[model samples]
Target: MTLPFPSLEDLVNVISSTVDYIVNIVYNTIRGALIDFYNWLMASIEWLLNYIRANLPFVISVVLTWTALYKSVTAENIPLTRRIMNILTAPLFSMFALSLVDALLPREIKLPRYSYPALAIASVYAETEARAEYIIRHRTGYVVEAEAETEARAIYSLGS
Candidate 1:
Protein backbone atom coordinates (compact mmCIF):
# COMPACT_ATOMS: atom_id res chain seq x y z
CA MET A 1 0.00 0.00 0.00
CA THR A 2 1.44 3.38 -0.95
CA LEU A 3 1.11 6.00 1.84
CA PRO A 4 -0.58 9.28 0.72
CA PHE A 5 1.28 12.44 1.77
CA PRO A 6 -0.54 15.75 1.69
CA SER A 7 1.50 18.97 1.23
CA LEU A 8 1.50 21.50 4.16
CA GLU A 9 -0.07 24.25 1.93
CA ASP A 10 -2.85 21.88 0.83
CA LEU A 11 -3.61 20.85 4.42
CA VAL A 12 -3.70 24.52 5.51
CA ASN A 13 -6.01 25.45 2.63
CA VAL A 14 -8.37 22.60 3.44
CA ILE A 15 -8.58 23.58 7.12
CA SER A 16 -9.12 27.26 6.29
CA SER A 17 -11.90 26.52 3.79
CA THR A 18 -13.71 24.26 6.27
CA VAL A 19 -13.55 26.92 9.01
CA ASP A 20 -14.80 29.62 6.62
CA TYR A 21 -17.72 27.44 5.52
CA ILE A 22 -18.77 26.78 9.15
CA VAL A 23 -18.45 30.49 10.09
CA ASN A 24 -20.59 31.51 7.10
CA ILE A 25 -23.29 29.02 8.02
CA VAL A 26 -23.37 30.18 11.63
CA TYR A 27 -23.49 33.84 10.61
CA ASN A 28 -26.32 33.25 8.13
CA THR A 29 -28.39 31.29 10.65
CA ILE A 30 -28.01 33.97 13.32
CA ARG A 31 -28.80 36.74 10.84
CA GLY A 32 -31.88 34.97 9.57
CA ALA A 33 -33.20 34.42 13.11
CA LEU A 34 -32.63 38.08 14.01
CA ILE A 35 -34.46 39.22 10.87
CA ASP A 36 -37.36 36.94 11.62
CA PHE A 37 -37.62 38.23 15.20
CA TYR A 38 -37.60 41.80 13.99
CA ASN A 39 -40.36 41.09 11.48
CA TRP A 40 -42.47 39.42 14.16
CA LEU A 41 -42.06 42.41 16.49
CA MET A 42 -43.01 44.81 13.72
CA ALA A 43 -46.08 42.74 12.85
CA SER A 44 -47.18 42.68 16.47
CA ILE A 45 -46.84 46.45 16.70
CA GLU A 46 -48.81 46.91 13.50
CA TRP A 47 -51.53 44.65 14.81
CA LEU A 48 -51.77 46.68 18.01
CA LEU A 49 -51.96 49.92 16.02
CA ASN A 50 -54.71 48.54 13.83
CA TYR A 51 -56.63 47.44 16.90
CA ILE A 52 -56.32 50.89 18.43
CA ARG A 53 -57.37 52.52 15.18
CA ALA A 54 -60.40 50.30 14.93
CA ASN A 55 -61.50 51.41 18.38
CA LEU A 56 -60.30 55.00 18.42
CA PRO A 57 -63.27 56.69 20.10
CA PHE A 58 -63.68 53.98 22.72
CA VAL A 59 -59.98 54.05 23.48
CA ILE A 60 -59.99 57.83 23.81
CA SER A 61 -63.02 57.82 26.07
CA VAL A 62 -61.60 55.11 28.28
CA VAL A 63 -58.24 56.81 28.53
CA LEU A 64 -59.76 60.18 29.41
CA THR A 65 -62.23 58.80 31.92
CA TRP A 66 -59.62 56.59 33.54
CA THR A 67 -57.16 59.42 33.86
CA ALA A 68 -59.75 61.67 35.42
CA LEU A 69 -60.92 59.03 37.85
CA TYR A 70 -57.33 58.27 38.85
CA LYS A 71 -56.61 61.92 39.45
CA SER A 72 -59.74 62.51 41.51
CA VAL A 73 -59.09 59.47 43.68
CA THR A 74 -55.47 60.53 44.29
CA ALA A 75 -56.44 63.99 45.50
CA GLU A 76 -57.17 62.78 49.02
CA ASN A 77 -54.23 64.82 50.33
CA ILE A 78 -55.53 68.06 48.91
CA PRO A 79 -58.08 70.38 50.57
CA LEU A 80 -61.48 68.81 51.00
CA THR A 81 -63.30 71.52 49.03
CA ARG A 82 -60.89 71.25 46.10
CA ARG A 83 -60.98 67.47 46.16
CA ILE A 84 -64.75 67.59 46.06
CA MET A 85 -64.63 70.00 43.14
CA ASN A 86 -62.23 67.81 41.22
CA ILE A 87 -64.35 64.74 41.82
CA LEU A 88 -67.49 66.52 40.67
CA THR A 89 -65.98 68.08 37.55
CA ALA A 90 -63.49 65.38 36.56
CA PRO A 91 -65.67 64.12 33.68
CA LEU A 92 -66.16 67.53 32.03
CA PHE A 93 -62.57 68.56 32.77
CA SER A 94 -61.28 65.32 31.32
CA MET A 95 -63.14 65.92 28.07
CA PHE A 96 -61.77 69.44 27.73
CA ALA A 97 -58.25 68.34 28.61
CA LEU A 98 -58.32 65.47 26.11
CA SER A 99 -59.70 67.77 23.44
CA LEU A 100 -56.79 70.12 23.95
CA VAL A 101 -54.42 67.20 23.75
CA ASP A 102 -55.94 66.02 20.46
CA ALA A 103 -56.01 69.46 18.90
CA LEU A 104 -52.73 70.94 20.16
CA LEU A 105 -50.31 68.08 20.60
CA PRO A 106 -48.81 66.06 17.74
CA ARG A 107 -50.81 62.99 16.78
CA GLU A 108 -47.80 60.81 16.01
CA ILE A 109 -46.86 60.71 19.67
CA LYS A 110 -49.26 59.75 22.44
CA LEU A 111 -48.25 61.96 25.36
CA PRO A 112 -49.15 61.02 28.91
CA ARG A 113 -52.57 62.42 29.72
CA TYR A 114 -52.54 61.43 33.40
CA SER A 115 -50.92 64.79 34.01
CA TYR A 116 -53.93 66.57 32.57
CA PRO A 117 -56.00 66.27 35.73
CA ALA A 118 -53.09 67.45 37.83
CA LEU A 119 -52.55 70.42 35.54
CA ALA A 120 -56.23 71.26 35.61
CA ILE A 121 -56.16 70.99 39.38
CA ALA A 122 -53.07 73.18 39.55
CA SER A 123 -54.49 75.75 37.17
CA VAL A 124 -57.44 76.01 39.53
CA TYR A 125 -55.28 76.01 42.67
CA ALA A 126 -52.45 78.26 41.44
CA GLU A 127 -52.10 81.64 43.12
CA THR A 128 -50.50 83.46 40.17
CA GLU A 129 -51.20 83.94 36.46
CA ALA A 130 -47.57 83.20 35.55
CA ARG A 131 -47.75 79.86 37.29
CA ALA A 132 -50.98 78.97 35.52
CA GLU A 133 -49.56 79.98 32.14
CA TYR A 134 -46.44 77.98 32.80
CA ILE A 135 -48.53 74.92 33.65
CA ILE A 136 -50.62 75.44 30.53
CA ARG A 137 -47.61 75.72 28.25
CA HIS A 138 -45.83 72.84 29.93
CA ARG A 139 -48.88 70.64 29.59
CA THR A 140 -49.26 71.68 25.94
CA GLY A 141 -45.55 71.07 25.16
CA TYR A 142 -44.99 74.79 24.65
CA VAL A 143 -42.36 76.21 26.96
CA VAL A 144 -41.13 79.81 26.85
CA GLU A 145 -37.64 80.68 27.98
CA ALA A 146 -35.86 83.94 28.70
CA GLU A 147 -33.99 85.31 25.68
CA ALA A 148 -30.39 86.53 25.85
CA GLU A 149 -30.62 89.16 23.07
CA THR A 150 -33.34 90.93 21.11
CA GLU A 151 -31.96 89.75 17.76
CA ALA A 152 -31.69 86.16 18.97
CA ARG A 153 -34.71 84.60 17.36
CA ALA A 154 -36.38 81.68 19.02
CA ILE A 155 -34.18 78.64 18.34
CA TYR A 156 -37.22 76.45 17.83
CA SER A 157 -40.55 77.79 16.74
CA LEU A 158 -43.87 76.16 17.47
CA GLY A 159 -44.47 72.80 15.68
CA SER A 160 -40.80 72.50 14.81
Candidate 2:
Protein backbone atom coordinates (compact mmCIF):
# COMPACT_ATOMS: atom_id res chain seq x y z
CA MET A 1 0.00 0.00 0.00
CA THR A 2 1.20 3.61 -0.71
CA LEU A 3 2.13 5.77 2.28
CA PRO A 4 0.92 9.38 2.85
CA PHE A 5 3.90 10.89 0.98
CA PRO A 6 4.53 10.59 -2.78
CA SER A 7 6.33 7.61 -4.28
CA LEU A 8 10.04 7.22 -3.39
CA GLU A 9 11.03 7.73 -7.01
CA ASP A 10 9.23 11.05 -7.27
CA LEU A 11 10.71 12.20 -3.95
CA VAL A 12 14.23 11.39 -5.14
CA ASN A 13 13.68 13.27 -8.41
CA VAL A 14 12.48 16.42 -6.63
CA ILE A 15 15.48 16.46 -4.26
CA SER A 16 17.91 16.01 -7.14
CA SER A 17 16.34 18.86 -9.11
CA THR A 18 16.52 21.21 -6.09
CA VAL A 19 20.21 20.42 -5.53
CA ASP A 20 20.98 20.99 -9.20
CA TYR A 21 19.20 24.38 -9.15
CA ILE A 22 21.16 25.57 -6.10
CA VAL A 23 24.48 24.44 -7.57
CA ASN A 24 23.83 26.22 -10.82
CA ILE A 25 22.98 29.47 -9.07
CA VAL A 26 26.14 29.39 -6.96
CA TYR A 27 28.37 28.44 -9.88
CA ASN A 28 26.98 31.14 -12.14
CA THR A 29 27.45 33.81 -9.46
CA ILE A 30 31.08 32.90 -8.89
CA ARG A 31 31.86 32.65 -12.60
CA GLY A 32 30.27 36.02 -13.36
CA ALA A 33 32.31 37.73 -10.63
CA LEU A 34 35.58 36.23 -11.90
CA ILE A 35 34.82 37.16 -15.49
CA ASP A 36 33.99 40.74 -14.55
CA PHE A 37 37.21 41.07 -12.54
CA TYR A 38 39.30 39.78 -15.44
CA ASN A 39 37.62 42.15 -17.87
CA TRP A 40 38.24 45.13 -15.59
CA LEU A 41 41.94 44.28 -15.16
CA MET A 42 42.43 43.88 -18.90
CA ALA A 43 40.73 47.20 -19.60
CA SER A 44 42.92 49.03 -17.09
CA ILE A 45 46.13 47.64 -18.60
CA GLU A 46 44.98 48.45 -22.11
CA TRP A 47 44.23 52.04 -21.14
CA LEU A 48 47.64 52.44 -19.55
CA LEU A 49 49.40 51.05 -22.61
CA ASN A 50 47.50 53.39 -24.89
CA TYR A 51 48.27 56.37 -22.68
CA ILE A 52 52.01 55.62 -22.67
CA ARG A 53 52.03 55.11 -26.42
CA ALA A 54 50.36 58.47 -26.99
CA ASN A 55 52.59 60.38 -24.57
CA LEU A 56 55.94 58.69 -25.24
CA PRO A 57 57.50 61.62 -27.08
CA PHE A 58 56.57 64.08 -24.33
CA VAL A 59 57.93 61.78 -21.69
CA ILE A 60 61.20 61.37 -23.58
CA SER A 61 61.58 65.12 -23.99
CA VAL A 62 61.12 65.64 -20.29
CA VAL A 63 63.67 62.97 -19.42
CA LEU A 64 66.24 64.34 -21.86
CA THR A 65 65.72 67.90 -20.70
CA TRP A 66 66.13 66.90 -17.08
CA THR A 67 69.25 64.89 -17.90
CA ALA A 68 70.84 67.75 -19.85
CA LEU A 69 69.99 70.26 -17.15
CA TYR A 70 71.52 68.04 -14.50
CA LYS A 71 74.72 67.32 -16.48
CA SER A 72 75.27 70.92 -17.53
CA VAL A 73 74.78 72.20 -14.02
CA THR A 74 77.21 69.66 -12.59
CA ALA A 75 79.99 70.01 -15.20
CA GLU A 76 82.93 72.06 -13.94
CA ASN A 77 84.30 72.83 -17.43
CA ILE A 78 81.13 74.64 -18.49
CA PRO A 79 81.16 78.45 -18.25
CA LEU A 80 79.69 79.92 -15.09
CA THR A 81 76.97 81.82 -16.97
CA ARG A 82 75.75 78.68 -18.75
CA ARG A 83 75.91 76.76 -15.54
CA ILE A 84 73.82 79.40 -13.81
CA MET A 85 71.31 79.28 -16.64
CA ASN A 86 71.17 75.52 -16.35
CA ILE A 87 70.79 75.77 -12.60
CA LEU A 88 68.00 78.33 -12.79
CA THR A 89 66.10 76.40 -15.40
CA ALA A 90 66.64 73.23 -13.40
CA PRO A 91 63.43 73.77 -11.49
CA LEU A 92 61.47 73.54 -14.70
CA PHE A 93 62.97 70.17 -15.48
CA SER A 94 62.67 69.30 -11.83
CA MET A 95 58.91 69.82 -11.95
CA PHE A 96 58.66 66.98 -14.41
CA ALA A 97 61.19 64.87 -12.53
CA LEU A 98 59.44 65.35 -9.23
CA SER A 99 56.06 64.46 -10.68
CA LEU A 100 57.43 61.30 -12.29
CA VAL A 101 59.20 60.20 -9.14
CA ASP A 102 56.24 60.83 -6.93
CA ALA A 103 53.81 59.08 -9.24
CA LEU A 104 56.05 56.19 -10.30
CA LEU A 105 58.46 55.44 -7.48
CA PRO A 106 57.56 52.82 -4.93
CA ARG A 107 57.56 53.73 -1.26
CA GLU A 108 60.63 51.61 -0.58
CA ILE A 109 64.31 52.64 -0.56
CA LYS A 110 65.26 49.91 -3.03
CA LEU A 111 65.80 51.15 -6.57
CA PRO A 112 63.73 49.69 -9.38
CA ARG A 113 64.75 49.33 -13.03
CA TYR A 114 63.22 52.67 -14.06
CA SER A 115 64.94 54.64 -11.30
CA TYR A 116 68.45 54.77 -12.78
CA PRO A 117 68.04 58.17 -14.44
CA ALA A 118 66.29 59.57 -11.42
CA LEU A 119 69.17 58.39 -9.24
CA ALA A 120 71.71 59.98 -11.55
CA ILE A 121 69.82 63.27 -11.60
CA ALA A 122 69.50 63.22 -7.82
CA SER A 123 73.23 62.49 -7.41
CA VAL A 124 74.16 65.41 -9.65
CA TYR A 125 71.85 67.75 -7.74
CA ALA A 126 73.32 66.64 -4.41
CA GLU A 127 76.89 67.12 -5.63
CA THR A 128 76.10 70.53 -7.03
CA GLU A 129 74.40 71.60 -3.82
CA ALA A 130 77.29 70.40 -1.69
CA ARG A 131 79.85 72.22 -3.83
CA ALA A 132 77.81 75.41 -3.79
CA GLU A 133 77.50 75.26 -0.02
CA TYR A 134 81.23 74.66 0.36
CA ILE A 135 82.09 77.55 -1.91
CA ILE A 136 79.76 79.89 -0.12
CA ARG A 137 81.02 78.87 3.29
CA HIS A 138 84.76 78.63 2.54
CA ARG A 139 85.19 80.96 -0.44
CA THR A 140 87.49 78.35 -2.04
CA GLY A 141 87.23 75.21 -4.18
CA TYR A 142 90.64 73.83 -3.07
CA VAL A 143 89.51 73.62 0.53
CA VAL A 144 86.39 71.71 -0.42
CA GLU A 145 88.39 69.22 -2.49
CA ALA A 146 90.83 68.79 0.35
CA GLU A 147 88.00 68.24 2.80
CA ALA A 148 86.44 65.67 0.50
CA GLU A 149 89.79 63.86 0.28
CA THR A 150 90.16 63.88 4.04
CA GLU A 151 86.63 62.56 4.50
CA ALA A 152 87.31 59.77 2.01
CA ARG A 153 90.52 58.86 3.77
CA ALA A 154 88.83 58.81 7.14
CA ILE A 155 86.08 56.61 5.78
CA TYR A 156 88.59 54.21 4.23
CA SER A 157 91.04 54.18 7.16
CA LEU A 158 91.33 51.01 9.23
CA GLY A 159 93.27 52.50 12.13
CA SER A 160 91.85 53.44 15.52
Q: Each candidate's lDDT (Cα)?
A: 0.54, 0.53
In angstroms, the error of model 2 at 11 is 1.6
lDDT of 1 by residue, 50-71 (tens): 5665556455756877777787
Off by over 4 Å in 2: 79-160
Residue 40 lDDT, candidate 2, scale 0-100: 62
For every candidate in turn, the CA RMSD to the true structure comes to: 22.1, 26.5
* Model 2 lDDT tens row, 81-159: 9888886786677667656655664432311111001011122354555331211111122122123443433332211
Decoy 2 TM-score against native: 0.44
What TM-score against the true fold does each predicted structure earn?
0.38, 0.44
